[model samples]
Target: MHAIRIEEHGGPEVMRWTELPDPVPGPGEALVRLGAAGVNYLDVGARAQGTGGWAAPAVLGAEGMGHVTALGPGVHGLAVGDRVAWFYHPGSYAELLAVPADSLVKVPDGVPDELAGGVLMQGLTANHLGTETYPVGPGDTAVVHAAAGGVGLLLTQLVKARGGNVIGLVSRPEKTDAARAAGADHVLVHSGAGFEEAVRELTGGRGADVVYDGGGADTFTSSQLALRPHGVHAYYGPFMGVPTLRPTDLPNSILLTYPVVHHHVATREALVRRSGEVFDLLLDGRLTLRVTGRYRLAEAARAHADLESRRTTGKLMLLP
Candidate 1:
């Protein structure tokens, strides 16, 4: 089998498509033949800095869907040939992955392989923002930064589905339509800050009920400014840049939260349940998975490059 491997952390150039032995399922593990792997900024962070569990000399991916080719002892409720998807298992960039069966959810009939493969990481994050972080409700307004990006698009659709209005913030003018197409009630073209005033104007001076901020530091203050007093600021876009602030730096009575996807799915039961919620929306057509770029597994470096350039919108997938 072949997988993208990195011996050192640096640029996308560090990722190498190298040949390796095929993986075999161990106890409670399912051998998954990689159908597709979602390329996230998380993977880029891992490749560049060996972030978290992704140390060097490792395969580089976290979320994906695949077919069950084999099952190990004690792996029940799953069988060979079952199509399964996982939200996070690490080492998912390979042609085959031996993932713990409990870590996966069965992909239902209506969801396509590519969509199943790509949606969970970002989908679940969006779910966390809308359902838990702020609990969006009817007539509430939300500010979604990078509204054409993967998480942004999903978050926009979810906020709208939950009866909240979305004011999408996109980096370029070309992305405005994509945000609107995803059900953004209003779309603003922004390069850095300054979208707050428009959000306030749209909300008639009350500001948004919550701001799903993925713009990182450059737009942090503005994200706060866009929110209503006591409104939630869910900052999940640390990859763009991380900003620090004193407690006194907070404006208004706005609540600031860094909602981690893990906290939302901290247990096996929670993982299955939250994943079901996202998948149900996909099946019902309330949520859409847009694959803006698809690359052969070997071309992952180029995919990373495209993602980092911020020119690619929606999802990018790697097929093995």
Candidate 2:
């Protein structure tokens, strides 16, 4: 099997496309022939600084869509030739993956493999963020930082579909258009001076009922200010480096919460249930998975480069 492996952590250059031994499914696991794999910023972070959970020479990818080719002992409810997608910690950036049977979710008949691969991780994150973490409601106002990025765009659309107004913050004008296309009611460039003021002005003096802070260090403080009195601030990612916050940094009238999807949806059953709900929304056309870039599995290095350079938008997929 061919997989992208990082023998040592450093930069995109460290990601090597090399031949690796095929993974053998263990009991309660299934061997999946991967169709597409999603490349996330977490992959970048893992490759740059060895993922704390794993040793070096590790295969790096968190989620993907594939077909089950073989089932290990005790595996049931899935069979050979079953079309499925899964979320796992590592080993997805390969032609074949050995994933736990419990991790596999049957892909609906109409959802293409590409879309399935692109949306699994980001879509689920967006679902938990909008519906569980902050619970956006009709007439609610929210701010999404890096709103043109992968999970950000999907989250903006999901929030708006539920009738919430979204104020998006991006680093470029092109991203502003991208966010608007994804249902953002207002878009602000985060680069120039007065970006926070722009957010304040857009909300007409009063700020948003919630602020989704994905761009960590660069936009955390501004995101805090963008929230309305007693508003919920959900800080989900650290694409810009994790920001530090003190008790005094938060508004007296607001509440701050940092929710990780894995922690929120703790058990396998919970993950499957919440993922199914989001999948239904996707099938109904209420949610859109915008795949902004696609790369061959062998071009994993280039993909990481593009993501780090901020040359792409929305989801980035690796076709196997």
Candidate 3:
């Protein structure tokens, strides 16, 4: 088997793709022959400085989709040859992965391997943010930062599906059409002058009902300012840098939360339920899974570099 291992915490060069012994299933785990793996900001953060309780000299990645090749002892829900997708477990950037059986979700026949891998973590993230975190509804206004991003595009669509008006924020002008196509009511340049004021003006000085800020350092303050009184602010990702929030940072006593997806879907039942809804939306054409980039397993470093550059839109995948 082949895998990309992080030799040390640093830049993209730190990842070394090399051969390795094939992994075997352990108790309550299953061996998966990976078809595709999801490339995420979390992976880049792990490559720079390890997280999710991992150290150097480790295979890096958390989500992937493939076929079950072997079953471990005490695992009964799944069998060999089943198509599956999973997230949160590490070491997914390889030809084979030994992941817990409970973490595996059966992929529908209509969903391809690449789309399955690309959507699990990111889809569930947007699911929780749009449905559970703020529960967007008719007549509500939403401001989503990184609007052309992987989760951003999906969240924009979900928000619109629920009849909420979307004010999408992107770093570049080229991304406006994509955001608008995703059902965003309005698309605005995030780095441009007076973006928060623009949001206020769009809402007639009332501000947005909900603000989803994934680009932390660049958009955090503006995200807060764009929210209406008693509105909710959901901060999930901090690509630029983490922001500091004080009580005075928000006007009108707006709500602030840093909701983690893992915590939202902590139970296996919750995971299945939320993931099933996301897949249903895709299968029914209510949600479109945009896999904007692809790379070979050997090009893991290049994939990470592209993701961190923030030039790419939608999900990026690695074919193993």
Best by lDDT: 1
lDDT of 2 by residue, 109-205 (tens): 8898998887878888888889888888999988887889998899999999999998888888778888999999888877522466777788888
- Show the lowest summed lDDT stretch of 10 residues, model 2: 191-200
User: In candidate 1, how many clashes are counted?
Assistant: 0
Q: Each candidate's lDDT (Cα)? A: 0.93, 0.84, 0.88
- Top TM-score prediction, candidate number: 1
Q: Where does candidate 1 stray beyond 4 Å?
A: none
lDDT of 3: 0.88
Please give the lDDT score for candidate 1. 0.93
Flag clash pairs in model 1. Answer: none
**Model 3 segments more than 4 A misplaced:** none
In the predicted model 3, the residue pairs found to clash are none
Model 1 per-residue lDDT tens digits across residues 15-71: 999999998899999999999999999999899997766888989999999999999
Residues 1-320 of candidate 3 have per-residue lDDT tens digits of 99999888999999999899998899999999999999989898788977556788889999889999999999988989999999777889999989999999999889988888889888899988988799999999999888898889899988888889999999888989889889899999866325889999999999999998887676777777888889998988665578776787677798998878998689999988988998898998989978889999999999999988878988899997
Instruction: Point out where model 2 deviates above 4 Å.
Output: 192-194
